[model samples]
Target: MLRELLADTIMQSAQLAERPEITTPPPGVSAHFSTAVAMRLAKQEKKSPMEVAAAIASKVQENAPFGLFLAVEVAAPGFINLTLTPDAHRGVLAEIREGGERYPAIPRKGGRTIVEFLSANVAKPLHVGHLRNAVLGDSLSRILEASGEEVVRWNYLGDWGTQFGKLIVAWRRWGQEEELQKNPIAHLVALYVRFHKEAEKDSSLEEEARSEFRKLEEGDAENRHLWERFRAMTIRGIDAFLVRLEIPPFDEDKGEAFFEGDITPLIAELQERGFAKESEGALIVPLDAYNLPPGMIRKSDGGSLYLTRDIANLRYRLDKYSPQRILYVIGNEQSLAMEQLFAIAAMLKLDSAQLRHVKYGLVLGESGKKFSTREGNTVAAEEILDEAQRRAVNIVNE
Candidate 1:
């Protein structure tokens, strides 16, 4: 936030810092700096950059803002360049000392924020692929908290999904209860990987998986028992891993799937509010205003999606905490979906609740490609962590 404010302020202050004559003809060339301000102005003013630079230089004199510059120069095509005196730099230093952290910084205003992150599936071990969300979400939550916003850090685990059924099948087929006693996550991951391998040749495995999921969803004793055990094991592993990385434990809300049982009324409310509509037997909220791809609320199979569950979750949050804002520290890949969600929320007249999506770019491999960690993998989070630690150790020792 401060970064954004400073950029704006710097541009504004630069204009005022220059003499009127220097800035009038060029429009944007400032007498206080030397970084293409005149060239940019020339482009905007439809003149040669040199002409802009000359016009700006003509007005520069001793009596500039902060008493920083006495003259300006026109360089190359149309660049107004400035040579600042020692007093200017010293004054800046003084300003820095006086302002402290708020040196051109946006003051933290009180508000409530909900941060959802690290939503990996429960059936599989949280792999290297899931590290970005965990780290990024956790970091953003910390930053928000530090900035004086009341933050509710949510993990939103992908625990309630179809993959769990496959895990259940694997556990019944070839799982060892004794090994799970030693290390639950490793034991479950082994079974999960084995299940995937076996399911390839045996097509009947898919049906078996679905049956297991149905039983679990219907609250069958055995399937529920297995899922509980798996969820506990995975969460425990995640906690330990986060500790090892020195990252604080993320708050958990378990995401949309966890709230599905309680979202029917939410869907009804959406219909009442005219936010959701039935399209080809599935529920959808049209997102033309958002300029995004169509977002599905519910699938034809009677299963809900993130959008529907999010509406329910938002309503729940609104009712419970009455938060001022919802911050999603998500990856850039889901930008369109997030925009659509925000648009729908707005259409439902949730103007009081500010919805923000902080998206980060993809972390690419050194070769500028998407990273993978399989046999032919280019990148792995664990390996990156290990190497980082190694470098730190070397630096400390040196």
Candidate 2:
């Protein structure tokens, strides 16, 4: 479509007819005229660029469409720059009139996709690193949706882990009853930080945390209630923050614990398919092809890890939605983990469900470092939104 209209002008002129190539623009200059065409062409023709440019300029001035090119001149070694007239500049405005939003971009014909991201542990406060992941994933989902694919946004909350047992112990020990009622996420993060610091000091705390985790896994009513309460309060807090930021938060599945009752059969299926094997008492899937040290499905203590839960989650999604693709948006550091997971999934013969991992780079601060909050050396995620708003307010006042 583009070539039909422009080919006439390109072919008729003697200089352009000899030119082997053409180009659009330059790096630093922003002009209505396409500047780099003659330079790009001269190289292909194997001619001295200034001579080629001079010849091209004469032809361009004579045969240019709408008498647009005011000048065609050689700059530096071989740069042939072309400047357009005011009348030629107005053509861009005419194109804008022709197309509104669906202008020149081609539409994608991909099938439905499931995007899973922002699976931060409910026990801790979201840090700066998590903020970037959340924002990037949310933006990408919007772009996919715009391009005509059905997008199912998900948050695989990290609710099931050994850390919960420690949190349960810490809550019973130093957690304030009133502060938790006021702001549960902050209280839970404080308790989690304290529990890790304590466990480091007193090694016996590890065993205690393990015992508590086992009790939680076994569906002890008291531990279950505590976990549920913590999860609910934290989700509420996160919802408030998302609402303030005007971000559409995903429909959260919470974690593997949410589907714990149904995972037994899936784990059995993995073992039946020979995808799962016992390695030092832990159920693992050897992913040599992926260059990963086996993906652990279960720990030596007969407790399930992330792989087991993911396999179960994959099966559940396939049965429920039958989506064409599943996108895992996480940090680049976990590339090996995702590769292993997909390899194991293939071994289990669930290859129909397409899996994608969109890894993103860090949003560095002014010092060209990963943004941090607690240490004053980097910008905090919490403060970024407020700072943007303050800048907007100042600009409006000016």
Candidate 3:
């Protein structure tokens, strides 16, 4: 409030075309507030910055209302610094007191924000890497919601593509009903890992998996049913993890599959609009103008790529939510892919919404190695739960 008052005072005294920028003076500056309005106006008036600053300081000292400043002084170059009177500081406290219990709330800006995070592929355990994404995204959603924005916490599960096809093949070959019922995600993870291991031994398994995915895309009833079962089981497991960790549930769990139908139409539009061209039998959006590599939208096999789905997702978000901001709380390793996504969006000339890739770093194990499935090591789960419970108890007692 005081800074705003100071800004208003500067705006009036200097007769500024716009309100001047005001800020808290850094320590050792010996002032409560500071502005550089005079420096910005110097070229307009054909006067040196220091001369302009002195003139504004004199006028502010003479006309500032409410006894706001104990002293108004001109500092180096063109900074006009004000040392506030005690009464001015007391007035700020009175304003805060009037705000009462609702002080944390902000004025509404009339737009929603969607934070998509912890988007771990289904059929995998929630690991340390996913933990960072969840915590950061959940915290950010809370902060934005408190700031009076309607926030949608989304978990865009990675439920589509060749991986599921391979899993379906693995299920038919080796899956047991008992094992699946025991722990769905863990069993799916094992079956998927088994598929990769067998694929190493038999080269034909790769083609078989791809064929299964094609059938799935064509809506084979058996393949679609299996995929739905996988998704349902995985969501239940993921929700249990979130409950134990106290992370909130997502408003939407629609995965890459949600935008699958839109991709074909989108690709056609891109080609029609001259934004896409065929390269090596794959559809790509050339990004030479953006100083980036070509962004592949469809693979040579006619499978829609993640980039294509992400572009469709952006369009869907605009149509469905019209959010002011869309934050992708992803990992740092995918920075380049995120760059490509944004560039491709620009190529398509999609409606504008702030698309931010809020990247986070890896979670190092106790031995300092990044956690990997192939490495066969996991942090002590009981230890983490114990520590969390202890802290929770302490909070309750206090």
CA lDDT, every model vs. true structure: 0.69, 0.73, 0.84
**What are the TM-scores, per candidate, against the unseen true structure?**
0.66, 0.70, 0.71
Ranking by TM-score: 3, 2, 1
Q: What is the alpha-carbon lDDT of model 2 when measured against the actual structure?
A: 0.73
Candidate 3 pairs with clashing backbones: none
Q: Write the per-residue lDDT of candidate 1 for residues 1-398, one digit (tens) a residue.
A: 32233234334555534322222234465545454566767767798878766665554443235555545676686555665567766767787788764355545677888877776556455555567777777777777766777777777777776777888898889999899898776677677777777888998998999889888878899888888877877778777668876777765546545787876786788779876788899988777777766678878877777777777677677777777887877779888878877787788776677888878777776687765321233343566678889999999999
User: What would the per-residue lDDT of candidate 3 be over residues 114-205, giving only the tens digit for each residue?
Assistant: 99998977776777677667789988987887778889999998989898778889999999999999978668778887888889899898
Model 2, 1-398: lDDT tens digits are 23233334545664354333445656875532343455666778887767666676677667767655666666656555566666655775577568654444446666778889877667667666767777877887877777777788888888888888988999999999898988777777777777777777899988998999899988899999999998877677667667876668776555778777766787787789776788777787778776778888777877777777887788777877788999998988778778887888788777787998899777667778764322334443566768888999999999
**Superposing all C-alpha atoms, what RMSD in Å does each candidate have to the true structure?**
8.1, 6.3, 6.7
Model 1: lowest-lDDT 10 consecutive positions: 16-25
- Model 2 CA deviation exceeding 4 Å by range: 1-110, 289-291, 361-380, 388-398
Residue 171 C-alpha lDDT in model 1: 86
Model 1 CA lDDT for position 99: 72
> Which is the leading candidate under TM-score?
3
* Candidate 2 lDDT for residue 277: 84
